[model samples]
Target: MGQIIIFLVLLGLGYFFGRMAESRHYKRIHQREQAYRKLLVMPEKIPPLEFSQHESTLVSGNVVISVDYFKTVAAGLRSIFGGRVAAYESLLDRARREAILRMQEEAKAKGADAIYNLKFETARIGQNAGQSLGSVEVLAYGTALIPTPDMRAERIARNNLVQGK
Candidate 1:
């Protein structure tokens, strides 16, 4: 009886902390998503020819995320039941979104107007011989199109007048 009680207590603690951390991560992700909504990301092989004056360069972002202890235990049980593992699904979703956000940030830093030819690469990392899934790594890459020097100066001047600067 004592051992069972201890096990339950540990499970409860794991669930509580794991849920808190996941919630915080999701909140942060949503905030960043909203902040970067203006960044154009697409999977086309080539940007439209109408913007031929712009220059394109490669940008990439990578992120690694690990499952919490509670999630690992839940996934183990789910395997026995042979159904979907929602915990791992959410973990991957968060990692993918974060990777995209980081990529967008890099493009923004370079004054890119849009991203094209977007692609993703995923890998599993940090697993020992006997260990379960240790972590997931997500890489997002794309071509960033930046306006020409003349266009940038025009945009800056237009914005200055609009803001009364």
Candidate 2:
């Protein structure tokens, strides 16, 4: 029967897709973790020159990344039958955390002692031509400031010396 043949085709397609998605998500997660690790590797090395006291303040930046087209197609096929797709959720969650962590590290590298001004923006990137199973991403950033009186004094002295006011 034609119906039977169509059903077989769909089923075969689904199986193949699911397998491919399994591997793709595995690799994506691996890459995401590696990215997080790279962001976190900022060693606490002082600059070659004598460190100047800076009353650092928090600053931040953010971005969102959508799921790939292949991923969307695979998820659509899987959704025709069952419960939630845990892999998709896990991937997005990990990405969100990585984005935030990257922003935090960026602030730290810029000599911020503590970060304060935080913001997050999220939206789906470009859409795919076929499947509509995309995701929204959220990014955040903040400034870091030193919390020491010595730094505050130095900053004040510098400001006064600059303006002669």
Candidate 3:
């Protein structure tokens, strides 16, 4: 009885802390998403011809997220029931979003106006002896278009000249 009581207490603590952490992570993701909304990220295989005046380079981001103890327990129960594992689904979703955000940040750092040919790769990492998924990894990659500084400067100069500045 004492062992059962201890187990329940631990489970409750895990659930509470897991929920809090997940909530905080989601809030941070939402804020970052809004902040990067102006960045153009697309899955088109070919960039538009008009934007080809710029140089294109590759950018990528990867993130690995571990499942909380509560989530792992929930997933085990879900597996026994032979149904969807909502806990794992949310974990993967969070990982994918984070990977995309990181990729966007890299592109922005490279002075890219847009990212095209976006691709995603996902994998389960760190499996335990029980074959349970220990963590998930997500990779987001794309080609970023960087405008030529000389061309931009010329265009600005032309505009200023036309405006009689």
Candidate 4:
């Protein structure tokens, strides 16, 4: 009886804290998503014609996120029932979004107007992968398109024309 009580208590605590943390992370992710909306991300092997005058460089963002206690417990129970483990869905969503955001940050820092050929790689990380749930590592990579000097000059001239300068 005592052990059961302890388990319940821990489960409740895990649920409460996990929910709070998830909410906060989601809020932050939404805000950053909005901020980076203008930075184009595409998964095409060939860039559009407009990007032909640009220089390309590889960029990547990696993030490792651990499952909360509540999620792990819920997933274990879900596995026994042979049903979808919804608990892990949000965890993956957050990880993927965060990885993309990080990649966009790098591209922005390098003066990239857009990222093309976007790809993702994911791996499970833990000491005992078979027996226990572990952290998920998400990697987002792409080619950043930066305007070359000639392209920049042409853009400047075009802007001047539009402004009647």
Best by lDDT: 4
The sequence of per-residue lDDT tens digits that candidate 3 reaches over residues 13-120 is 989998898899999999999988988999999998877899989999999998888888888888889989998989989999999999999999998888999999
State the lDDT of candidate 2 residue by residue for 100-150, as single tens digits: 666766765664544444555666655565446466667765445443677
Query: Can you write out model 1's per-residue Cα lDDT over 69-127, one digit (the tens) per residue?
Result: 77877888988899999979998999999999999999999999999999999999877
For model 2, the stretches where C-alpha displacement exceeds 4 angstroms are: 1-58, 64-66, 116-119, 129-131, 134-136, 147-149, 152-165
Score every model by TM-score: 0.90, 0.47, 0.90, 0.92
Off by over 4 Å in 1: 1-3, 128-131, 160-165
Q: What's the lDDT for all of these models?
A: 0.90, 0.57, 0.91, 0.92
Candidate 4 regions with alpha-carbon error over 4 angstroms: 127-129, 156-165
Error of 1 at 80 (Å): 1.2
lDDT of 1 at 51: 60
lDDT of 3 at 109: 92
Best candidate, TM-score: 4
Worst 10 residues of 2 by lDDT: 41-50
Give the higher-TM-score candidate: 1 or 4: 4
